[model samples]
Structure formats: structure tokens, C-alpha cells
Target: MIPEFWGNGIAANPDNYLDEDEFDSSYEGLLRLSERIGDAKPKGVPEHVIHTLPTKPYLMSKARSPDERCTICLSEYEHNDWLRDLPCAHDFHKECIDSWFKNSDKCPICRRSILENKEL
Candidate 1:
């Protein structure tokens, strides 16, 4: 018979060692185990979730013109309306662009990092 389950709260399976439900639920347990055994620390908030500075307006000068609309809010830019440029050189309306940057660091169209990495 199986021993009474206690401590970490995960019950050992008698048959299959790799139960899908247990594996899915074991993330917190595994994290705790890693900390105890490997001296690993808990992960910090991902950079993608963190907000950063907006791209400067001058960068828009290098952006490529598109016959396409802004994918963020699905609105098109007027011929000479203010547009914000991403490091990827994609352009969007200043208002729409500001809204996106506040929520995420990725370009709405390409998912490129706007602040974590300069390579974009």
C-alpha cells in the first residue's frame, strides 16, 4: 500500500511515474525543490511585462510607409498626422502607439522588444 501523503503534498503515483495532471500541478513544487536543492531563486517579472520609455519621434523619420493600417487598434494614419516609430521601424498613430507602450514593450505587429533589447 502507498504511504500516507504529507509534506510537499504531492502524492507519488503507484503505476505511471509521469502523470500529466501531477506534472502540470508540480510547477510550484518543482520551483520549491529547485530552490532547496540548487539554491535557485524565484524568477523575477519578465522584461516583456515591464513598461519602458517610448521611442522618440525622430525615429519615425526612418520608418517605412505602409499602405496598411495600424494593427494595434486597426486604425489608419492620416497623410501627415503624428505617428510614433518603433525600433523595428514600424509606424502607428501617436495616440495608438502610446496606448500600446503603456501595456507592453512589444510592437503590436511584430512582437519585437521595444526596451529590453536594443537590437530590435
Candidate 2:
């Protein structure tokens, strides 16, 4: 007997079509679960990783000056503004960086792990 639909092994297999529907659902589930895996804060990170980082006031000094703006908010750093100094020595607004670290442990600019060289 001849096959009703003849082609490569996959196209000839009727089960493949049925599996495609199931596979799409499975793929969607996986995508939803990992949507935040890249560049986003993965679930289960501890809050202290952010809180433990150093924070200081943005005092106007010849030293420790800002980069003309806050990298996080993209706004200029006013006098007496707060800063969250990363382990890499890059600083951002306290509120901005703190909110950032909650989602990630790396510096937004340097991409260095804020956890680097620190005893956890």
C-alpha cells in the first residue's frame, strides 16, 4: 500500500503535527518561566545583596564627584543627593541603585558582580 502523505520522515508522521501543538504549549511555559532570566532579576536572590552595598550622601567634594549625571535615572546629581556606591566604585542614586540591585547583583555600568570579592 502507498502512504497517504509521502515526504521526509517527519512530514510523513502524523504524530508530529499533534506533537507540535503540545510542543508549543511546553515552549510557551518555558518562555514564561525564564522571561526574566536574562538582564532581569532572577527569582530567589536575597535582599541583603543589595542592602549590604555601601550607601553615602552625594556631598560636593573635589573628590568622589559624579559623572555629571546619575546613570540609573539619567538625571543630574544635585548637591546632597544620595548615592549607592557599588563594589566596583561606580555610584548611582541611592534609590535608583537600590531598586536595581534588588533585580540584579551586577553594576549597571561596569557589569561587575556586586558580590565580587565580598564574603557572603
Best by TM-score: 2
Model 1, total clashes: 0
Instruction: Give per-residue CA lDDT, model 1, range 1-120, as digits (tens).
Output: 434564333555455366676664478888876766884432322434332334333333346566556677776554566666766878777777677666566777888766655432
Provide C-alpha RMSD values for all models, in order.
10.5, 8.1
lDDT of each: 0.59, 0.72
Candidate 1: 10-residue stretch with minimal lDDT: 42-51
Backbone clashes under 3 angstroms, per model:
0, 0
As a whole number from 0 to 100, the lDDT of residue 56 in candidate 2 is 81
lDDT of 2 by residue, 1-120 (tens): 345546555568776665555554577777865674553535323576677777887767666544667888899887788888777889999888877766677788988886667665
Q: In candidate 1, residue 55 scores what lDDT?
A: 38
Considering summed lDDT, which 10 consecutive residues are worst modelled in model 2? 36-45
